[model samples]
Target: MALSLVHFPSEVWNHIFQYLSAADKFSVRASCRYFRKLIDHWSLWKNWTIVLSFKNGPYNSEFWDSLRRRKVSSVVMRNTKTKDWSRLSLALPTLTTVIMDQNSNGNLNFIQDFSHLNRLAIRSSAVLLDLHTQTQLQHLTHLSMCNVLFPNKSNWSFLNLLPFLSSLTSVVCHNTNSFGQRDRMVDTLVSILPKLKHLSLSAKYISPQRDGSIFKPVTSLSSLELIDCLDHSSPEDVGQMISGLKCLRVFFKHSHQGRPEALSASVIYLKTWLSESAQLSNLTVVKGPPVRMYATSIPATITNLTLCVSGLSPRDMAAVAQQVPDLLHLHIDAWPSHLGAHTARIPELFPKLRSLKLRQDHVPEKDFLRLQQLQDLECLEILDRGHWSDLYKKLQTLTRNRLRVVTSSPQRDAFHCPCVSQVY
Candidate 1:
């Protein structure tokens, strides 16, 4: 009868030290000194991310060796004789999200000492970073990078050394091939962030030299996500080469390796890059099907949306889901002839969906029981990847008739996080 560190409480010892594991949350912060001051909360490492790696291989894809045998506890270094990772103690200044080892070239000088950086994900090697002693990231806003190697005797200009970070908006330039030296990295990041709104340009032919006139400083975009992973140009030649966005909302998933690559990448030449991206609202497409789905619609104050219907068509996604009038979120996957004729055509294809996430195994079982006849579905996630217990017992005889489903699959090192106070 003994378990009273002054009768618990410290939020139940920070919920029993956040149920450990992260190598016992770094050995319970090297055990005691009063549980390392209740596990050093900097939001306990604010949405922390620290992925480590090492490589030199002869393997030929099993998805790049199960992604280099992941299980990164904290600091790791293989083939090591530590030649500078700039003093790693997981370089935590309460880091706000980071991922390393796209074959560790390290040195963005530990992300120029994060000081309330919103998010900055990096992979692959360098894209120039030496902003003459960066001053505490000036509240950086979500930036992602993956510019493999481009140092043919560098002069640095990955957005001209963050000219006054200016609370950047959101930029993601994935695997930017040889990212920089192209409009000095997209015209010095649209002339220095300036409340720039979301932008994601994935592998747009990774600079074998492009001068799309630096997307004419995209005029404070609203949203944009373009992934052209070198399927050899043709989303209307990268939409007339970066069609000067004017408050673009979002448009991407763009990775079509031929087979009608969005109909020779021209849905009316992407509606003239969506009519020069003005007041554009939402579009999240992951390619596959979109050769003609958008000819001249989608811009009635550009309502909200998201798409990836494999390779689109079921009568053009039921005629743009019947002209979206503020559509919330719809993510559908499984487009092999939209099985069994689209389950009696879900109310003529999404008549104003609130939230729907039906994926993978390609929406079957009578179109998932006609998705409980959606009268404005608040939230529905029928995500399947095999063995969904006969569709969770037909969603418990259709709609929460108690399948008593509060199950746990637990198999991450077999245990340590199954608590609702660890069950009955």
Candidate 2:
């Protein structure tokens, strides 16, 4: 007897197709008319990403033509060529989110045609758009650009262009030019965009000095993120800059260089600022060091905390942990040598922690067992790629005990599973 997928009900077919690869799904579509109709369902086409090197591969018009009937809301074009970006987007009228990589020194002409764009991200190269082209993006609420640069190296010219994007509520400027002209980028952004609620900037783009006149209190901002790129600023300088965010709720910063003393000092100053000026609801710091373990205190308003530190000490960890009694989600990344002493202290440090993520550096078995001690923990993830048959077996036992241990391999966004190795 031959096995027949057609014998299955439509719901069963849909469930089965969800587990198949994209190529396998296409194969199923080609097998029968019923399957073809089922595969073209709008649910399957709501989000799609197409990658092509305009410099190498031919334009896939058929791919774009097929999306016309589907409800594609988001699309990503990777390694995109400099030619007509307008024509590529003209085909997708339903697209609300567009992410593209434009070649070096490419004109941002394609973005002008996206009248319905709500979110736009330029992931590669700097973009220089004319005033007329900037006006067309009045509907854009979120914009992310990489390595932003304008002609003549004049910061005022760039600032002048942003007011035209009045509808922008969120802006992310990453890897911006670090010349002295942009010393007041934050103040310029807040002054120009009254509706901006969220902003993210690379720390290197901002100067350490405080511009009291330009950087006054702004109540409109709700969230802020800063990515460190060899920041030379002091903690007091950093604190003063963020102190004006009176309505800010979420503040996340990642100092890639991991200057523990400077970061701790900033946090200490920020804590004082938060108490006096604005209150932050969520705080996440990456590559942080324990400089003020004895002096600094974590704010009580922080319920979600993530601290990625190197060379963490037991006393320092205990001191930092005591600051947040209401924390529900905690993610810690530290050297394995410094982690052992804190194993038994995990439950005591975060009594209310519901989600725990520990990066696999050199974790001991006792630490994992101590993590299992937290009765309130609902999710636990161990991230790394290495031979850990013993650890895997221990986690395997957790699944049987009704405590699912999620483990992921080297991939950044891989899903968690008790048996990740077998599945992968």
Candidate 3:
């Protein structure tokens, strides 16, 4: 006597249905009246996001009616063509977020129709903004535009319209080149958007000089990400930026250029900032040498550190152990050939470490097993070029099933670790 799905309680069906896509839910609804009633429940659609693909052709009235009945609040539009958005405004009155991507012939005038919109993201799209409109997105708190383009008109730029979005707390703008004066642009943004807390922008757009006035107005800013922006800036300029921001907890820098001279200079500058900046706890340096060159300068305050370099030596590990004794989380990406005999020392080097992530091409099973010495370690993530099923099995046994091992290919797998909670 096999149990049928219908015999299960509604709660079990609801739990299973939550994982299904909107299309799958529709199919289930058409299969039976009981499923239809379950799908029609308002709670089922509360967190659902409707995806509108204009490239697939215009949706029928029935589609709009379904969304209206479900009270869809979020929508993602792809390959959007020029269409009358007035219909969307009438159908989804509760719409609060809109994400548009790969749209070249669309206009943002439709945004004016949704007064309740609080989040807007435009990526790889060129859309027209009606700057003359008096309506404002008063509720908008987040705005992200990546590789987006607006009309060349002086008044049509997104920068010109940012002042009107007074409620915005986070802004991410990347690869958009309309910003004329980067220094003044940053200063103006901080001065106007007093509530802005997290700002992520390209370093090329900002001046390297430390403007004292800029930091004075941005007390609310806690997280700042400057991408590919450290090529020209001096260490002193970066140090001043860190020291000025009293509330800054996370500072991330990614540099594509790995000049030995720049990296050496960075070592000195980082030492100075690490000693001075009391609030900075999490530090990540990608595509550069590890901070072991000036290991003595690394403050004990830093608990989470990530170094994405070509190689790390045992001598470097010793230096890190002597300095950042309180380190709890560490992520390292190093060449296997250069990390000679260093894995065996990790447990002794970072005894306080709670989580560790290693990205290497090849690691010996014996060396990998040594990590079990870290009694406090809760999770171990490995990104290797080759798989080691045997090693993983041995490691699980050595730890008495207390440790969680997550392994993936470095080239193809997207590395995700539970220990890394913050979105950098």
What lDDT would each prediction earn against the true structure?
A: 0.49, 0.60, 0.65
TM match of model 2 to true structure: 0.78
Error of 1 at 221 (Å): 24
Task: For model 1, name the residue pairs that clash.
Answer: 223-249, 252-285, 253-285, 253-286, 289-311
lDDT of 1: 0.49
Candidate scoring better on TM-score of 2 and 3: 2
Supply every candidate's count of residue pairs whose N, Cα or C atoms clash at under 3 angstroms.
5, 0, 0
Candidates ranked by lDDT: 3, 2, 1
Local error of candidate 1 at 343, Å?
Answer: 10
For model 1, the stretches where C-alpha displacement exceeds 4 angstroms are 1-87, 90-107, 110-155, 159-171, 174-199, 202-224, 227-236, 239-267, 271-305, 308-317, 320-344, 347-369, 372-394, 399-424
Q: What lDDT is reached at residue 185 by model 1?
A: 39
Of the two candidates 1 and 2, the one with more favorable lDDT, higher being better, is: 2
RMSD of every prediction: 17.5, 5.9, 5.4
Worst 10 residues of 3 by lDDT: 411-420
Best by lDDT: 3
State model 3's lDDT.
0.65
lDDT of 1 by residue, 1-424 (tens): 2456735766786777665545676787676556655666544443333434334433244423322232222232223213323333233344344444344333454555445445655555543445452454556676566545545444554544567677778777655543433333344565666787766665343243344433343455555555543334333333333444433323344434355644543455456566555455565544533534563465554455555445555665666665665666665554443434464475556656656655425556776666656555555554443566766567556756522322232223211111101110
